[model samples]
Target: MRTLTFFNHKGGVGKTTLTVNVADALADQGLRVLMIDADPQCNLTAFYLDEKKLDALLGESDDADGGTLWSAIKPVVDGKGGIKPVDAYKIKNGLYLCPGDVLLADYEEELPAAWTGSFARKGRDYDVMCALSAAAREMGQRYEVDLVIYDIGPNVGPLNRAILLDSDFFCTPVAADLFSLRALSTVGRAVARWITDWKTVRGLASAESRDKLLHGLPTYLGYVTSAYKVSSGRISTRPHDYWESKIAPRVKNRVVDVLRAVDPTTVPFPSNKLAAIKDFHSLAPQAQEYGLAIGKLRTHVNSGYNAQILEAATEFSGLATIIRKRMGI
Candidate 1:
């Protein structure tokens, strides 16, 4: 199965929004898709369920329950009846989600302790990464999933580290801002470190260990600029000149290239002009009348909102196609 992670170290960059929408879009295209909500905020899961539903899902959570991701992935891997299928709430025609739990954040403190016993057991029956890989593989086998979209949270802790080590390709979604740029650099470096360190731990190295590690590492698909608004000057004007010329190239030169040094196959996602999702204020409720996400508001007064969503969908679809082709999915 092909795994693609939508990640950014900095939050509020629309990582979960894009991941949910892209998974929906891919499902529309008839691809069997599984979205693993790896974020601790559970925002993606919230998008699929309202407050009451979330309460039911979290009924009487204890430390033993896989309410958190680390527990869930293990059972799926071991076939020990540990993993339970998510209910039909978010189940679409060709899409399913493992869903995220808020408890994931708490697991951060417990990861090293949980993993200590297996660290020294070389060639043992199980390792942390193997369990995750096995989970991915088994799920792929069961669902025959064409795509596995991982919606990861901020931070480079054990969870993110494990996901990076197991992912096939990653697409970073960052806001067009300075902090996002810095995060791009940080996450890039962390991914590189995880790859090399994971290889060392996997016992797959030899005299050509460095070369082999590079060969086995996941490809880094470059970042996507999200939540941008177009310039108001003219229809032809691009507001992201700073991003196109300055931010993109700097990341490519400083970060992507270094990762490529370890593995040349690493390539950027489509370098399209930033797909701008115009932020529209939701209209005042007329007697509690509802409307779609703000984009639908523009569809009535003007077609711009629909056009924007379509364009964003198209951009993600292109990235999806590239990822699929690379993974031969």
Candidate 2:
């Protein structure tokens, strides 16, 4: 299965929002999509389900349920088992979600312990790292998923390190701001460090031990500029210049290229401009409140708003189309 992650070390870049919408968009195209919410905040899960429903799935404390991504991997953290059978929640046709849990953050502290365990070729560390991968593979096969989309929290900790390592590709969603630009450089260096450290651990492990662990780098699949205005297929507003002239190139030269500094061979990366997702303005808040994609807001909007709805259809669809091409999904 092709596994991809939508990640940015900085938050407020619409990562979770874009993730759910993208999953829905892909589902609309008759492709099976599984969204694994690895963020401890559980925001992605909250989008698709209510607290009452989620409570039923999670049940009580000490439950070994795999209804959430945390429940699936929590056993590994507790030294009880490997990844449990992840019970993904169906959010309508062709779209599924392995929800996130707030309590998932509880396991974050043990990541350093798990890191040390890797040196002795232990199963716990490998098991924790590959938990999501195992879930993705099993669910992808069960659902015949076209792609597995992971929505993870913004961090360079052991948690994200493990998740990203197991993923095949990573695409960042960036806000058109200098903070986002600065974050790219930091994320780039952190990603390189993760890859290098994984290799060192892998080298120390025996063949049998290595077989249980996840190693190597996830390819950088370029970035999408979000929270930006668009007019007639070009960036709109004054900040548009910053995004076009500065943010986009920095993502390429500063982030993607810097992350690949270990490789001696030079290869030009793919165009960093995937698609500029429009800010969607008032439509976004209304859409989120109603749990609808920007493109699907027509069902909830008045007849006077057709033009804006149409714009959303074009924008979100173009995003799905371009990203699908990049992923061969």
Candidate 3:
């Protein structure tokens, strides 16, 4: 299965929201999609599951097989064993979720030591470093999924570094604002470092451990400009238009070109803008409350939201199509 991650160093850019809706849209197109909620905030998990269900899944338990991503990698983090098999929870016909845990944040503490040990070719550190990727791959194989999408926290920390390395492609979800534009440089620099570090790790690692590593860095899929204002079927307001106009050039200069400098042939896509997602307005909160995608909101709501619902469906459907073509799915 091909792996994709929606990431940005800056939060509140609708990263998790894009992940959920895009995965839902892909599933609607009949692809079996597996979503790995690697974010410690657990927003993606909460978007799909209610409080009671989350309690059942994340509550204190002595059982080693707790069915969350944290549980799957806990053994390796504790230096106990390899990843334990954990079943992914089915959200719909073709969509599944590997639930996120607040405790997943604990893995961050071990990463520094793991990274240091990796230089010495310590087998156990390699196991710890590869834990998340290994679990993702095992779950993907078990489910026979067509695609695996990761929902990661907004940061350039060790956890996110490992998660991004495991991905095949990554898309940044950004807002039409200066913060998002500035974050592009942070993301670019971090990814460039991670790619360089991984290459060194692979060269130092034993053949067995090297074989388990991802062969290359995650390619830059593109950026998604989300939550922009729309009026009379066009981007409205001067501030919105001005910032939106600034996004493409900033992305190319700050992100795409930076990656290309690291490895001139890394980016294969022609465009820097993937999709511009209009603000869903009230539809977003309602969909969140009902644990449904905006396009699927119509099934749970009345007739008042028909127009917005159709618009949301069309937007996500078109976004999904672009993603498939870009990924060659």
Give the whole-model CA lDDT for all candidates, comma-separated.
0.59, 0.76, 0.86
Off by over 4 Å in 2: 58-61, 227-239, 264-268
Better of 1 and 2 by TM-score: 2
Global CA lDDT computed for model 3: 0.86
Q: Please, what are the lDDT tens digits per residue for candidate 1 over residues 86-135?
A: 23234667887765676656544444543343344332223333444555
Best by TM-score: 3
TM-score, each model? 0.75, 0.90, 0.95
Candidate 1 segments whose C-alpha is farther than 4 A from its true place: 61-90, 113-119, 122-126, 204-216, 227-238, 268-319
Better of 2 and 3 by lDDT: 3
lDDT for each residue of candidate 3 in 1-329, tens digit (9 for 90 to 100) = 89999989898899888888899999999899999999988999999888998888888422575878999999889888888989888989899999898888788778888988888898888888889999988999999999999999889999998889888899988887667789988998999888888889899877877998766589898988875555457765666567778888888888888889887665788888888888888888898999888988877888899999999899989999899888888
The per-prediction tally of clashing pairs is: 0, 0, 0
- Expressed as tens digits, the lDDT of each residue in 219-274 for candidate 2 is 77778887654545775567665576888778777777777676422123556677
RMSD in Å for candidate 1, one decimal? 6.0
Query: What is the Cα-based TM-score of model 1?
Result: 0.75
Q: Would you list the rank order by lDDT, best first?
A: 3, 2, 1
Query: For model 1, what is the C-alpha lDDT against the true structure?
Result: 0.59
Better of 1 and 2 by lDDT: 2
Clashes of 1: 0
Q: Cα deviation in Å at residue 258, candidate 1? A: 1.7
